[model samples]
Target chain A: MRRLLRVSSFRAVLVYLGLFLASTGIVLLFLHGQINRALTSNNDKAVWRDAAMMNQSYALGGLSEVEKLVAQQSQLSGVGVYLLADGLGRYIAGNVPAFPAPADTQMQEEGWLHLRLQAPFAEARARLVRFDDNLVLLIGRDLSAQQATMADLARSFFIALLLLAVFGVIGGGLMGRQALARVENINQSLRAIISGDFSARIAPSSSQDELADLEAQINQMLARIESLMLAMREVTDNLAHDLRSPLTRLRARLEKLSLSAQKTGQADDIEQGLADIDQLLSLFTAVLNLSRMEAGTGDMQQQKIAVKPLADEVMELYQAVFEEAGWTLDYVVDKAATTAHIIGDRHLLAQALINLLENALVHGVGSPPHLTLSLTRRDQQIIIAVTDTGSGVDDHQLAHIRQRFVRLDESRSRPGNGLGLSLVDAICRRHGGQLHLSNHRPSGLRCEICLMVRE
Target chain B: MRLLLVEDDPMAADLLIDRLRCDGDIVAYAENGEAGLAQATQDAFDVLIVDRLMPKLDGLTMVRQLREQGADTPVLFLTALDSVDDRVAGFAAGGDDYLVKPFAYEELRARLEALMRRKQLAQDTMLTLADLTMDVIARRVTRGAQEITLQAREFSLLEYLLRHKGQVVTRSMLLENVWHYNFDTQTNVIDVHISRLRNKLDKEFSAPLLHTLRGRGFVLQSADKLGDL
Candidate 1:
């Protein structure tokens, strides 16, 4: 019984039964009150009528005749009459061999009828009358027959209540069990999915219910996932073709050049060939790395990397480059113990930062020719800023800067494929972070790499 | 160097044949696995370079057949299949090295050299580079005859840098080569060990060797900017 109530649907059934039984019980109580009143009053009238007829018989005949009838009244059926006179107050007639006077006293006096209740015959009625001042006539009927009828009614009502209780319990249980079975089936399917079987799905129900609708929705979600997987595969195939084909051709060409230089003993040709090949390989591999980052590979290596020190290191390494390039380099590292830790791969992070800084440096020599690098932490985020007082970009150009191999220069070229900001964007996203670009105060393009500070 | 180059695609075969000859390795090129196997039975080479998914016979099946017949020549696989599972499959079929296609000529040359060198030395080996020597069995190192103590990881790091001496090994290279972790190339373990390694290599010496090229990566060499680089 305890376990049955533990199920919510089962508990709901019990609550329904409780409400149902309470209302039915109230109606039954009201009906029982009405029936008892009506039945007792109805019996009083019938018994009174019979008592009046016996009184008439007593008045017509004298006491001796009455006495003789009374002596045989036990043998006589239907009504019983007993008479008690003024002086004796003893039984003078029918079925009362001894005096049991108090019950019929009210009937003996007047027209009012009385019903007396005793152990077995709870519904008994009587009436009496005084005839010529010397004799009293009493007629009373013990309604043992009426008592049996009321007992039968009570028994039948008990049987009805018993059957209702038994049937209600079984019906409620079956309904709860059916509902639970559907829920359990859905739960099993969901568990299978959680354990990595994305193909697992809830069994569809024939009935058009909310459960069936939920199953249909889950299947739709799974379809979307499957399509995404297919798209990823297609991208990988295209990457292999486009990146590797040119690379293979370029490598073969370089090998032939080197061999020719060796055979011909041309010193300048050897040096030129080596330089050109190195440049091509570097550029190709960089582009490949950037594309790979963009395609959303798993970021499996993550650790607590202190950002300020890392940013400082990059600054130090490039400081000489910045100075020799005739750019005024400025830096403002936060003094507020800005050693914020973030979960990331250091090399990837460094690569992205290097791209942004180099972009700033290259852009610096073009216009106002000054660069600024800053690292700071604010509100559970690590922000590294690389600002250059070059031709600061407008909103449109700022958005375009992160597109693949996008360089806005109409001049010869900017040393790279213009993928610096794009690589920055990709690396930030891999760390559950983002790259935000905005105009620095009055001048310069500010590249902000915001990452989740490790807790 | 004598070699067998097996490839199915006509374009790929022509390019590879030209490149290997330019690299000055005597090459035997086969377009199918059957012809390649017949050549292997008739001749011996320094290395066997096979391409996967060939006509009539796949590369892995041919390699397996060769191994079954007690042919023990070192095999380097070249395939267009880039998936990690494909690599495992290639190696499981008795390949000695796996190279995804579109490789740089220099990378190919370096790998082939390493393969041949390792074969000559066998497994129980101590390795050496200019001014640095390391015992593989003892896990010990000495630079210019001066013995140095290093952490276990530091020893491994130095060993890797020394092995690939003069080449500009990227952080990714060190991560995979020394740490046996091919995946996460972004780890700072490479950076930290490079720092520790520089302190031991050239901190007390006249010049620093582990030069961190600005946007590139760490390279193991002398402190001065090498004129070629």
Candidate 2:
């Protein structure tokens, strides 16, 4: 419910409904006032008509005739108020027992007076007429019926407004949910694409709405991107095959020459040539692997790999190397991470960890060159961290160190192709994970490969 | 030893055939899979070196056809395709070994020898080289009368070396056969493990059996035997 309320379409509907109800309420209030005025005006006109008739009677006959007319009007309709009073405002003949208003009350426009009367006539509008014999007549109509009619009008208006609000909320909720679902479909497709599924696409809706148009445009873009990626992958594969064949033939020729040169004592130079060619081949292999992994075209044999055992194997491979170098090596697995398993290519994961260890062995120089390989679980991810007690890189250089052939100034003299970290980063990305580099606390460089833990 | 080489590249094939002939192995050359398959069916060779990409028929299909015909000769796939999937496909098609392009000659020789020795070594519970003996069933090792202790990985490594005794087994062969890892490490991790195993097996012995052949690889044979070579 809260998420639906956050939808822009739903909020817009609410705003529109609120404005509609407010304007409707104002219109109904205006109509109510107009109706009340019409009823009161009608009542005043009837009172004036009665007063005029009484005045005519007084003119024709005398006070006795006017009193007889009032008695007849009172008997004909119970709603009518008729009074014939003598000079001092005492009632002579009428349904009312006494004058409703005080003697000092002044008349309103056109000789109209509003009266707040006693029991049986709650409110009234009246007009007074003066006779030549110092007699006064009062004529008015009861207003309770007008008040009742207005109350009925207000009740109906409230019911109509309540219905509008109820239906608006329900309709707006439905509209918001529909829009949210459409957007979610697009999101799910994009997420699949991000997770290395190049074929994922949003399903086209049948309706010719704006959202459908957007979906169509996105599908076109995805198809274009997929084709471009496929082309690039083919180019890389072809390049690997084309370039490696000649190199392989050259190496074979060199090996053959080196064999003949052994008796002539020229084998050392040819051996160096072979080593150089081997280095070139390794560089080619690293570049090819990195590119394929980054392009998400690398073939992965995914399986459930337990975190602790994988780490242990990598550590065992490197433990002797570390010991020979007089470097202390520590391996730790957090209790929680011991049982953590991730679905990924085990060889690639081991390769990534091995790269980190090699990076440490080559660049990570310290008093004793201590190294630590640890595994820990954080939320849904398993972190495999390698820390070394070496002088860390500059904070600015840390960001670019993972790029291809990005060796630091001091490390240029070292024997490295500088593609190790880039390969590690590519491998991590292929597994739907990430490679993070930071300076370890107190000293040294820390590299972490975080992979998602699968249930 | 007799070997058959089925490769598309004439220059590479020529160089490889010359080297293998110099090494005292009889080599048969076929320019493509079609010719190679014909020669292989007509004659008997100890090992078949098939390149993956070839004209007329690819190496994988050739090997598949060979296996379907019930030819049990060991086959090694030589190709530029180094991906895990490609290797799996190679093995699935009945190739006994896989070697990526631009590999060292020693690496290829080591793997080919390993493939040829695979069937013979499977039935042996006791592996012996010189006075060093390993009882595979008991998981015990002894040099003459001294009982040797080895970690699980060290024992496996030594067992593989013993299986390929007197043969030059490259570091990659050790990694693949012993550790079962397909990727390479930047450092010489295998050398370190080998050194540790060497210390335990040869330090107190009169003759050093475990030997490192510099750029070639490692071999397990009596020092007298090595001097003869």
Candidate 3:
């Protein structure tokens, strides 16, 4: 509900409804005031006209004539009240039993008297006239009918307002939910694309609206991106094929030369040439693999892989090498990590772990070089960390190592082509995971491959 | 050994043919996939060495066509397309082995030998080279009267070496066959493992059965018989 309220479209609807209801309330109140004034004016005018005729009747025939006119007028109009009283305030002839008490009479503007009377006629507006013959005549109209009409108008106005509010809220809620659902659909498609499904696109909507137009535009953009990515992949593959062929021929020739030179004096130099060719080949292979992985064009055989066994296998492959190098290598699997499973390509994940282990073997040179390969589960992620007790990278250089061919070794004497960490990073991203490099407390560099655990 | 070489580059083909001819093999060469397929279909070669991208028909399609015509010749793909997907595609097209280009000649020779030997050794329950014997059914290895206990990985490594006894077995062969890993590690991890296996198999023996061939690879053969080659 809160999310629905946050939607701009739904909020607009609420704002419009609020303004509409406020204006409706103002208009209804104004109408109510005008209706009341018109009815009261009509009542006051009827009383004034009746009083004028009673005054004329009294002038022509004194008290008897006035008394006759009052009785006749009271019987003719159902809502009329007429009264003739003696000089001592005693009622002589009238529709009401007696004149109203002083407390029940309120003097209105312009000689109008508002009376709260008893039974049948609940209220009245009257005018009092005094004669020279010691008589008083009162003429007024019953205001019960006008009060009832006013009450009815107020009730109808409130009911109409309530209906408008109920329908507006319901309609607005539905509109907000619809807009939210469409937006969610677009978000889902975008997320799929982000996760390496370049073909994902938002479903076309039926209704013609701004959101529908946006969806069409997004789908068009996705198509364009997908085609461009396909073109890029084709170019990369062709380049790899074209470039590696010449390199292969060169290496083959070198190998041949090395074989013939074995009987000659410069066999060592030829062998070194062959080794250099092999190094170049390896560098080529690594760069190609990294670029493919980074572009999300690498083949991924995704399956549910048990974390412990994968880690153990990589550790086993390196355990002997570490022993041979006179380095202490430790493998630790947390209880949770043992059972944790991740959806990824086993070959690539194994390659990533091997890269980290190799990184440690080459650069991790402590007094007695120690390397730890540990797997632990944290929240929804399975972390495989390779920590080496060596001189950690300088704080500034740590971030640079993962970039392609960025070597921290200033002398450039290292055997690596500086693509191992970059390859590991690309592999991690291809698996929808991340590679985090941080310096271990005190000393050493720690590289962690954090992958999402399969449910 | 009889082999068919189907590759586009004449220079690379010539170098391969020269070295292979020197190694005492009968070689047949084709410059394109069309000519290669025609030659492969018309002849009975021990193994076929094919490059993936070629004129007329690509290696994958040629191999597919060859298989469709019921030829079961062992095939080893030698190509510059080294991605995992390309490897898988090669195998899917009826290739028995996949080797990336810019490869060591010894690696190619060893792989071809392994491919040619595959059919003959498929159902062997026991593998033996001289006095060293492995009972594949019982999972046992013995040198003469002495029994050798091998770890699981070491045992598989030994099995692979024994399967291709007297032939050069590269480090990558061991890693791929024994550990089933396709990617290469930066360090000499495989060498260490091989050394460990060597220690167990020949440390106390009078004759060293496992011999490292330096730049070439490792070969499991009796040292006394090595000079006969």
Candidate 4:
């Protein structure tokens, strides 16, 4: 119910219903006023005609003729009521029994009055006129019909407002629910796709509506993505097959040569040859893994992962490596941050951290490689940073460091194939995170991986 | 060790067989998976090296068949596909170990030796190399009545070395079998750990049991010992 109210269309329905009721009320009021005016104007015209007739009778024959005329006219079956009285305001023969209080005496001005008639006490609207000799007359009409008409109109307005509210809300709720369901369906399919199910696709309907058109477009896009993923997998497989075959044969031949060379008492060349081959193999493996990660088709499993333990394990693995490389390595895990967990492949996370630490150790060698690895919580994310006290990259070159094979040194004398940071960046992105490289103050590099704490 | 090498590439197979023979192991070569499966079932072999992609029958199918037939010979999958998913698939198909193509001969030899040694050493509760002794269940190491203090990870590292005492254990083998890491790090992290282990194992003793064989790997044996197995 709360979710339904949150739908924008439902809110629009409420606003529209309110507007409809207000306009209907205003229109009904205008019509009621116009009808009442027309009825009252007709009554006033009839009263004036009867008053003129009474004046003519009084002129022709004195109060006797006026009295006789009032008596005859009052007996007629019509809306008008007539009254005739003397100078002392005594009621004479007429339909009305007595004059109403504060009756007008002026000949030109007509006084309006409300009066009750015979049994059942029907209400009437009357006007008064006085003659030159203090003879007064009253003529009026019944108002029950007009009043009934206005009551009926008001009742109809209320019924119409009730119906509008009922239908508007019901219709709006149905439409909002339908739209929400369609959007949720699309969202579910998209989520499945993101979780490594490439075959998942939005189910489209047969209707030619806008929603169906959108689904169709989405399905087409997914098809393209699946094909592209397949092509990438094929390329990686083919590259592995074509290149590693010859490399394998070469290594085998090198082993044979090394054995024969050992017999001949000259084996240093074989050692150098084997070292170069190992470097090539490592480079090959790193590049292949980097590409696989970038392609978003890696065998990564997303599970609830605690960040502190992962950080500690990688740091432990690299601590002695740093010491052997003549660098002092230190690590601290914020206890408060240990509770933060993420959904990602555990091995990938550990590997990315190891790469960053190794990068610092390798490049930070020009100075004494004093490194600090820290894990902390930052705004719905866990930040794992490796800071090295060594020369950082140039400001302009920082942007290019995460690109493939983009070593900054012109000499290219470094042991890496320049894909370490790139791989870390790819792994971070795969986990819905990011890799940030910044210069630590007092001359050093700070590499951090920020992973979201989804829970 | 009698080893079966199932590879489609003739030249690579010939070179590998020659190298294995030179190392004093009798190696039987099969040109494809069909021939390899038949040969494997007909004879008793210590280890089977099967290539992933082969003509007539693939490595996974042949191994799966071998496993179904109750052939418990240890199988190592040799493939150019080194992705984590590929490795998972290789292990899923009843492979005991996975070695990517273009591997160094020393790595291959070390892995084969480790596989053979694992079969013979699975029942042991204690491991002793020279005067150094490791009580596996008690998690204690002592050398000539002197108890050696080591961290938890260092203890496991020493245990692995003592189990494969006479064999040459390569860095990749340690990383895979002991650390359970399928990928390699840029730095030689194994070297550092081995050095620390060396310090604790040999710094106070006259005969150093842990020896670094330069480009080869570490070997745990008494210094007075002279011959390879």
Q: In terms of TM-score, which candidate is strongest?
A: 2
Estimate, for each residue in B9-81, the C-alpha lDDT of model 2 and write its tens digit.
9988988898888889999999898999998999999999999989999999999999999999999999998
Pairs that collide, model 2: none
lDDT of 4 by residue, B1-229 (tens): 9999999999889888988997788899998999999999999999999999999999999999999999999999999988777888899999999999899888888888889889788889898987888898998889999999998889888988888887899998888777777788777899989999999999998888899886679899887773563
Instruction: Identify the runs in model 2 with alpha carbons over 4 angstroms from their true place.
Output: A1-159, B130-138, B142-147
Interface DockQ of each model: 0.21, 0.77, 0.71, 0.79
Q: What tens digits encode model 1's per-residue C-alpha lDDT throughout A258-372?
A: 6567767884665676567556655655565566566544222456898877776666555655665667888887865376788777767777787787777666444647888
After the best TM-score superposition of candidate 4, give how far the Cα of residue B219 lies from its true spot, in angstroms. Answer: 1.2
| Model number with the top DockQ | 4
Residues A177-272 of candidate 3: C-alpha lDDT, one tens digit per residue: 899899989999997776677889999989999999999999999999889889988888888788878877887787778778878878899788
Candidate 4 regions with alpha-carbon error over 4 angstroms: A1-170, A203-209, A261-273, A324-330, A334-336, A339-341, A364-372, A377-381, A388-400, A408-411, A436-446, A452-455, B226-229
What TM-score against the true fold does each predicted structure earn? 0.54, 0.87, 0.82, 0.82
RMSD of every prediction:
11.6, 3.8, 4.6, 5.2
lDDT of 3 at B175: 84
Instruction: Give the higher-lDDT candidate: 1 or 3.
Output: 3
lDDT over C-alpha atoms for residue B188 of model 3: 87
lDDT by candidate, in order shown: 0.69, 0.88, 0.89, 0.84
Residue-level lDDT tens digits of model 4 in A299-413: 7887889888787777777788887778877787787687889998888888898889888887866466699999888888889999999899898988999999998777999
Which structure among the candidates has the greatest lDDT? 3
**Recovered fraction of real interface contacts per model:** 0.27, 0.78, 0.80, 0.83
